[model samples]
Target: MKEYSVVPNKDVTGWMVKIEDVAPEKLYDERDAAIAEAEEIAQKNKPSRVIIMDQNHEVEEERTY
Candidate 1:
């Protein structure tokens, strides 16, 4: 399974979801939907930006022998 990152716009009106392995073929439509949803959830307390880090980016610690 691949990890994804969801970052909201600076205006706090929408969010951007990105995945390393999966590139969105069309982001215009998706962006609209995501924005609408975020706005609804955020309501009055909208977030300036939402950043979702990809779990895949997490690196495992290596032990030196």
Candidate 2:
């Protein structure tokens, strides 16, 4: 199954949507927007999962489609 994660940037200034097997990465200015984008992709690729990480890089939440 495919997977995606929304993680905080190293500087903690932004959020990143990390999609498995997809490079370059997707950055977002807002946390909500990043999560929304991740959800969109998760919905598109059903049977996948979306992981949300906290600023400390720990898993905060997860959702499966």
Candidate 3:
């Protein structure tokens, strides 16, 4: 199974969608955008899940595909 995570950027000024332990290639200005992109990716790649993290870097919610 694949896993995606929406987490705040290193500077905490933006959000990023990371696949597994790979580094995020893009940063989203909004958390919602990041989540949306993550969900879309998860949908494309079935048998995957999305892990949403809050600003505090804690898991806020999870969605399985």
Model 3 bad stretches (over 4 Å): none
* lDDT tens digits, residue span 26-63, model 2: 88889999999999999998999999999998999999
Model 3 TM-score (2 dp): 0.94
Each prediction's TM-score against the native? 0.29, 0.91, 0.94
Candidate 1: tens digits of C-alpha lDDT, residues 1-65: 23333444455444455443255312323444644443443343333332232224332221111
The global Cα lDDT (0 to 1) of model 2 is 0.89
- Residue-level lDDT of model 3, residues 1-65, one tens digit each, is 89999999878999999999498957999999999999999999999999999999999999999
Model 3: lowest-lDDT 10 consecutive positions: 18-27
- What TM-score does candidate 2 get on C-alpha atoms? 0.91
Candidates sorted on lDDT, descending = 3, 2, 1
- Report backbone clashes per prediction: 0, 0, 0
lDDT values, one for every candidate: 0.37, 0.89, 0.93
Task: Identify the superior model by lDDT, candidate 1 or candidate 3.
Answer: 3
Q: What is the RMSD, in Å, between candidate 2 and the native fold over all Cα? A: 1.5
